[model samples]
Target: MSRLTDLIAQAKERDLELGRELEREFKVLSARRSFGLNFERHRPENVELPGRPLRKGDKVRVLPPRGSTTKGDQRLWKVLRIESENGMRLARLELIGVADPESASVAVDDLVVVAEFRDYIYPGLVSTGKVERGGDKPFHTVINGENFYALEALTYTHRGRIDAIYIDPPYNSGASDWKYNNNYVGEDDLYRHSKWLAFMERRLLVARQLLKPSGALIVTIDEHEVRRLGLLLEQTLEGFTIQQVTIVINPKGVTQGYLSRVEEYAFFCFGPECKIYPGDDDLLTSKDSTTSDDGYSRPRWKGLLRSGDEAERKDREQMFYPIWINPKTKRILKAGKYLPLGEEPDFNVKDEEGNVAVWPVRKDLTLGRWGIGVYTFNDLVKKGYVSLGAYDKKRKSWGLSYLSEQLRKEIDEGTLVVLGRDPNTGVADVVYEGAATRKVRTVWHRTSHDAGAYGTDLVGKLLGNGRAFPFPKSLYAVEDALRIIIRGKPDAVVLDFFSGSGTTAHAVMRLNRQDGGRRQSICVTNNEVRSSEQYALKAENLRPGDEEWERHGICEYITKPRIAAAITGRTPDDQVIDGDYKFTDTFPIADGFEENAEFFTLTYETPVSVSHNRAFARIAPLLWMRAGSKGRRIETLPDEGWEVVDTYGLLVNLDKSAAFCQAVGSNGTIGIVYIVTDDDRRFQSVVRHLPDAVEPVRLYESYLNNFRFSMGR
Candidate 1:
């Protein structure tokens, strides 16, 4: 009867009556409950600390008044979401306005985390060393979540580090598949397409950063989201070229056809220099082959070629111009038998006055560009090649192989080759048709993925506790795409913020193990569950302990755990996971950045601020090279601009990390160590790594003297 009871019934199909009775007795009776408000833009009112930067998994106090700097213990709030623009980052917090808790969809400016996750804490703690090492394969992991914000945070926080990304983001199929905060987005909803498009737009904009230039991204989307996703990738990867593709998941659509319809669509977003998987070339057995009379091998071409129009096929009798006679027709043909070139008996030659005349006969003739293959008159031919045909004594002729030699000798000796063969056999240099006309279409070709039961397993295995997330994905399907894109690339990271059941993680690990490589993957996804509209907390609840909550943390539960478990079976004691995985959700992050990415300023924007704990720290060290430096910095050093920032080096606002050495400068060459937060220790380290930076500078107390050694003020 009730929604909660219905969910219980759905979870336990056979015991529906029992579930309904249990739910009736235990279900909360409060009727005033609803999903959280999904806000598109940030509101000004419901925020307290307007400048505090929000990172992943932060629980900040909410619903406070705008100006009140609530000092005591009341400023506690949960950072439900995070967003970024060209550079400015914002935090989406659930604020309970002092006057009314209903107006809680306000956003505030985020403050940079001087210290985030300093202590490595995870529910499932696995000692990797404790687990026996069978093979040094790529560790697999899975993270599950219920919403997009959580997915974005896990993936965005560590962008460049990811190797390959695969995700089955919401289909937005005008069905319940599209849920913003908690409300179900129907498939036929008028704004379904628009809502889905907007949702994907933000995710892709951030997802692009996670890819290494050579890294590949495979997105599984239905026909509805296919076109919009194409545009989204183009907008995000500005200079990059996107190779659009159509994976016919099903020929069968809502409407039926003469044939069985089967095919789904998938898109691979990559930089200009991306590679596709070549598949198992060794497994390609050329069943069909051709050979000359003397046993020389001839090229065999397969597949349907529909070069002729309907008119040509309609008049079939016209093409039957009588077969050329062969004296050795009765002779036993070679295993790889091929017919010799026939004379030009069928072609009509135009005379001087345009009078039609029989074409001249050549013992050996080719169709040239107009026809498909060569046909030679047999009177002068030899075993497999076209010989003198009783015309010349020292003549040698094969097919293409002979043609190549003749052309080479003719070009070198400056001799005109007219002895039954012309040096310039082709009228034009270009040959063949379109570049990709050779490969067949993707109709029946099943990529080892989509066809298997893996997708079904994905849904049934993890989220089958209640309402199963339907048709998650087969690991092979995404893996096939990965193999197509990145062959044997050893150094590539993967990302997928919309991970459904961690197929991408499985693909990455499987591929690396297959190729003995070391490719990594990063996935992001939200926890999904069916709940009733009784309480706001109940509608969108995510906290510690629940398996659903852990599963929603895909990096911890799904991606990483799966990988670790495959290496070491199931965790026994710890509640982190049931499988034996020496799983620790702790990833490496220090106060300083790796300085791996080269930074450049496109506009005369405010530069990054640098501070240090040691003396002699300055802003100039980010750009210029210095001795005794292991770290490096990259920044666009502007000579002049509208507003001056740090002049010594380019200044960049701190985004993810707490502290790092950087050369900060803005237009007009004004530079200084921009202190994002007042943490002097982090600021001190920023000064110490100056030697590691491409540029090095000594910090002074002021424009005057008193320089500190690797220290900043």
Candidate 2:
């Protein structure tokens, strides 16, 4: 074996040994698990609190039996121990700070986790009453809530339908950029990496279930956690092709300590059969200034000599040949015979002055092959597809160039093309067809992707003078990344769980406006109050959880307002800021998008128990979202809370089941109806009255099966 191959094998063996040693050490520490990473940490299950089995140390407010205690007699107690008696869990409690008080036993149901009842409520949407011009278009959604729970709610509606997901998650740079459970996790925290990993793992697992089999997930991160996030994604999303692309967001790098970091990473994890769609932005094209007699620039020239792998005569011996040419005019005359290795052929071509001309060969007389074989070269030459360049004294030979007939014809036809011009000579060096496009490279350094100009300045202009978000991504960069994946699939559904400033939604709307496609975006972000906002709110004695503080969060005050401004062609202050959009250069800045979007804040459903009868009302918005959030639900008596989508109606109230079915039967397009009734017999009876083309489905049954959770007794 070659020395390099041997060295690689030895390195591989050493790596295997190191891996085994690490495995053995982990096994010795009892950290090895069967299927996944084992951190050897205890994490309690997130359950509905205040009922069923209660753990020790839980606080309780005790009330006397019906007639024994007055309204003012109740006192708070703390659970000391929990034990099972007669198949019932009981808690031993002691009154707080009561001197010499005897401990009392009570049923586990009497005790509740502190402030846990408020969590039992389901999340609901509070519309901000702001929608843009296109009321008839599919509504792009910006959900204001904790993404974990928001994603859980979306599972009920958008499962397996999302076409692409682009998320710019926190880099965990220890800069107080992100918060976990309402508290910022700093760099010095012991479980910082673990917490971030766990947080992303949970969300990514859910996000995976939401992607179509042909969809892709694009995630952006910095060097701080790129490797960790990559491993986490590989472990969580197995059997997928994952590629990491380096994007130069900052050309002038940000200096940390020694090195200036200019690049971040994007991890693209795609399902089988998913391929990136090349965009026209980076395509090679001709310039307008370089016009020839035919109104098009001269065709570009390519070196006829092959250089890499197969350039040597031994690789493809038949490609080694000569072409007879006039020395002065630099025009091809005829083909010459091919010479085998260690053989030489004399070229005795004479110019008009009778001077013997030399063939185009390397200075050292090495036999290099042409780019194509003899027959291909002959065909190209016959079709005027070859160009002979001026002789070079230093190289001791003339340079042969090749041109395709299609390119020549395009040049003659005056097609708009991209031409590379020389600064000194003012000569067009090469020309390319305008229609030609190329795949985007891993490294993107386009000026349009500048975060400072496009992200901060543009967003600042839209939201007001002050910076609305810190280090927001460039809209054009996000749009370009998305366009690469969803170009042909224009009607695709996009999702961004960590939609910081709702840039993804804006890009989607802009894309739809550009292509007249009906693409929709679902953006989920928590209305977490930033530190700056918190300080401002503190001046007014308003803290988190206060109505005023909640209204001024990142989602409500920034994300939603920015989206509204982009759609309405005005700034947040109502000033018209309309013009040509700088990014994409295809749409007007203030064109007032012919698209529509809704702003919603997630709130919880009251009364913890979501019963079958009330389930429809609780999940009606979810059904509307599933139906593409097109038209509003009909809430009158004859309709009585029915959501219609084309010919399909989601029957929420079946009070007048027969009348609803009869009305649906009159409409020939109403082929399918989802009736929300718990009774199977009633559902079957309702189906009996439906039209022949219409099919009946039980909405409540499916809802219950999809969203079954533990409710404390």
Candidate 3:
């Protein structure tokens, strides 16, 4: 068994054993009446308040006490107990499940219940510019906010639609690359790995829900967290086929203590039907090729004689055949059918020297077969698809060659012509015509995949400024990975939660342009400033929330600007950098690319006491986005625009229910109709009047349940 499988089996066995032991211990304690020995510690306490009473199992937000050392680390906490201390109510709080070091206690007022893990409503996407080559609507999106909330919002619009996900999350390298709860996590942090795992686990849980059945998730990481991340993915994404691919991002290794690290890893977790598209064959250019035409070199040749087990006649007796050729002209004449053992086929033609031609059989006379069938060989010869190699005079044989249909077409069209003929066999050496495609390998070593060369330098040129984001991924590398997953799926939706520098989205756009596809991308990234940048800003007397500090953050200055520059072929300052990139050149960065993008910031609706009664207005945008964001919105009730329901149908006024239904039935082509009413009678009344074409769905109840936080008021 593989090491990972063996480890999983061992872990299961250990858990089973541990469970049995715990059960036996519990029985012994029950028989000896010792289960109740810790009765004082298990005593329950009741604390009453003016509003909703505090209870166990409720999720709450814990605010640090006035003079505590760990102040301002307000995080989601669970209420463990509620007791009275010195006539004042004190609630015990724990961080999710971890016990507080000092048995943290907070006043009843400070123990606020979490109303919502994230906002039920999100802001509309504001279009910055258009990337013209894409479809009428923008095919790419960038959300500048916390990824967790962004992913949650995506679940409403893109669930079960995204075909691939590529993310380069923080490696947790203890180099201040990431932060937890607004504080940078460093080497000395005790729960660094645990925190990272928890963060990934929650986001991945939501991310998994957003994938189609034939979708894949690709995550890039360094050595510091590869194994742990792999294990975490295995545990969380159960039943997924997980694979690890080693990527050589940095050729010149980064020096550490003893070893210089050069390689990182990409973890691919896919569903059952997920198939990778083998990229074009031009990627497999041989080292000896001289000139490349249109980003591809000449097609390399392979031997026609079949090798390995399949070469034996027993594997397929029909494939065992002979190919005939003219002795002087070296042109293929005919291919002979299958012959039994010890049987020789007759040839009609003879050599110019009056020598009878020989069949292409092994000297040992073993029953070996040709790579293709006899009929296939005949068809290839008829189309001049065969080439000849140097003659083996001692063995009285000549090497046979087969050309692909692409090569044959190229030769026929005169685009690829016969340069010369072989001196010995008189076979023509033809120039290759079109670019061929081949399957991508697991290990990538192309110069275009280099991080520093393509990512840093190319982005620097596009931005027309020297301020480069730290360790951005190579755009070509991301494109190649995505191309493999989204090869045949042109209209597939792609998502990236950790969309640093917006490379994934940029790659998606490039791939769409190359293939004339309409694939879309949704990128989610936070606006937090990097630790290095933050320190430098602080040294310059700029604080975290200051306008200057916020303006230079990763999401604001880096990711958005980079994507804008890439699409428009210009820097943020409108300086043109849209032409071909001179650094390690290939394709034009801005040619044929549309400058289309929508910038959105996730925010909570005002007056955040979001109960079922007042959630309709807050969740309208969420429902609109869920309906593909394809229609116009009807702001006021009884408006003339209500005559047309473009994408989504919403009804808030019960008095105009009949008119709304009549308008929808007459002129609307909506997919779903959301009816808002506190009374079931009114809901059913509206539903009964709606047409059968539109799906009638009741809002508020499910919305409240979905968005309500498990916290005390």
Candidate 4:
């Protein structure tokens, strides 16, 4: 009937066994469904790494002369050496990846570092600045570099340790929002969708390695590519359950031809061990119904009797029970034993003090089962969990309800307000204020999630400019999404590769302030100037690494300044922000968060340049991060044999193993010790003297091995 069937039939005419094998193969291929999203995997992307000064042995690209109409050479070049002539620096360069390489002498300032995605690069981190509010808490880090490279580097230090990752990637909305292979994939490009998929696939594969077994990945996107993204995530992240939630980011919709788009999607991908935690905000209901006088929400109760199929007494024998209540006062007294099959409870039975027995009976007169068994019901009733409501005439019994375990948790956490006991039910009447905790619904609609009011406006207040960044996510929305996964884990390590304006890190700090958590955030963003600004800068003869060009880039102008202002409670010019945070906690902007953060620019390093004393400063932060990011960091190889901080220790001089061992043993707070030595036997010998609680790490080898294997394409 079909082409495949006909081909199999023709093969069968020649050889029966061959045809059978062909049929089996064809069936397996058919099971691989495409669902319309299919494309060829393109070549790896290339990005220009700016800001770092040009030096010998670095791969670079030459920029054209000022006001020149012709384009500069596009071929990759390696710097041979730098020579100063007539008070001007000249770089000797040679073309790379070609048979007959050409060499030329050019101005050192004319070159910028350029890297291909498939190239292996030994990465380094260079600290730019740091801000400390107070305390010895772990520092939140923002790395100014391409996210793909940063993610690859994180695999070495934080593989399988991150608790949650929330990324707001580009929507691929046929604009200059994103780039592929050093060029923006505009609307006119027919292969834009394929390029977007290719870019995401590479980063997601590496990101998957960073999450713990129970970690979660939350990605936000608009309607432009929601369908394709969903399919890509499913195909790439196998074995992980994926669910999407619709959030009304902009109540006033942006018109797209016939439809006014008002909502975006968040796809949460997590393993089976992960669950959507309950929160106090029930977005499905109106704000007035959920919030109370105390800013919390009222407690919700459900019927204690089971409903629907398999709810009859015969279906669950142990759940068939009766609750005794005071007929006049309507107060629940206690629960009775579960009746056996075909056994009917005496509805007329009365206990001492005129307490009447109430059986779980359906309106159709069929015997129904209680949601909980006898022992559990009795325990809950004593804790004021059970309640009696108005009599149901059809069932000939009073309506009964009880708080589930989740609601009880909310009460214990003080998110729900217990106003007073009902005179009739004799059970606590609870109401949820604004900040109650409950399981989130599929659709989310709230004032706090509004982008224009909360997201864009809040950034304006903090940064002193309303248009500092385009289309940032609402602070509350990002915070709530993170809370669902990381509320229970106070020290969660969160990573956001597509960190536009450092909102993810700001959200993490807010969460820490609310619960005194020491959670840390790692944000990666580039310092690319906006397209409109880039054209203007080019007209002025400035290049990517120029001071004027770099200052206006996203990372320098927006992400970095926004994060610092949030931590210090002062703008870049040291002026106090003039506003108060509404809803949720409601605190003044002047009252800064109690948090610490450091800024670093990603550096591409060669293997030969990473020798012990040469690269210690660049590698110190990685060790600090791996050792829980707390305590004083050793920035260089100490003159002494070893250096011991609060949380980690380092021994650069292996010859003084005796002294290093004494220092490490004396420090009770040390958890990880880095021993710099090439000999494995000598390293292990000194490790024996250290306390068993201290984990010994072999230096240079331990760090280099991570990149040696990971750097290959």
Best model per lDDT? 4
Q: Give one digit per residue, the lDDT tens place, for model 1 in 328-388.
A: 2222111111222442333333335433311112223322121112232222122222211
TM per candidate: 0.43, 0.65, 0.63, 0.75
The parts of candidate 3 lying over 4 Å away from their true place are 1-135, 257-259, 281-437, 539-542, 578-587, 606-620, 631-646, 654-669, 680-695, 709-713
Candidate 2, run of 10 with poorest lDDT = 41-50
Q: How large an RMSD does model 3 have?
A: 14.6
Q: Give the RMSD in angstroms, all C-alphas superposed, for model 1.
A: 19.4
Instruction: For candidate 4, write residues 400-503 as lDDT tens digits.
Output: 98888777776777656577887666688777643555567779988889998878888888898544788899998999899889988888999999999999
The lDDT for every candidate, in the order shown, is 0.38, 0.68, 0.66, 0.83
Candidates sorted by TM-score, best first:
4, 2, 3, 1
How do the residues 1-713 of candidate 3 rate in per-residue lDDT, one tens digit apiece? 22233344555566977656655665565456432112111111111111234666555665444333343454566678888999999888777523333456888766645433332433223333334434454346777666776776676567787899999999999988886654677999876776677667767888888888799999999998998888888876777899888888888989978988778889989877788776553332331132355454344455566677667766777766666666666656677667775665554446575444435544455545677778887776555556766776554556666765556665676645666665644445555444333545567666667899878887787777676888889888888789889979978788999998999988887887777777778888877777656556665765544578678878788888888888777788888775574322256765526535656655443223333334344355556556554445443342432334576677766787777787778765577777766788888888888777787766655455443442111
Those runs of model 4 whose alpha carbons end farther than 4 Å from true positions after fitting are 1-37, 53-57, 67-72, 78-104, 286-421, 424-436, 465-467, 711-713
Off by over 4 Å in 2: 1-122, 281-435, 465-467, 606-618, 635-648, 652-655, 665-672, 685-697, 709-713
Between prediction 2 and prediction 3, which has the larger lDDT? 2
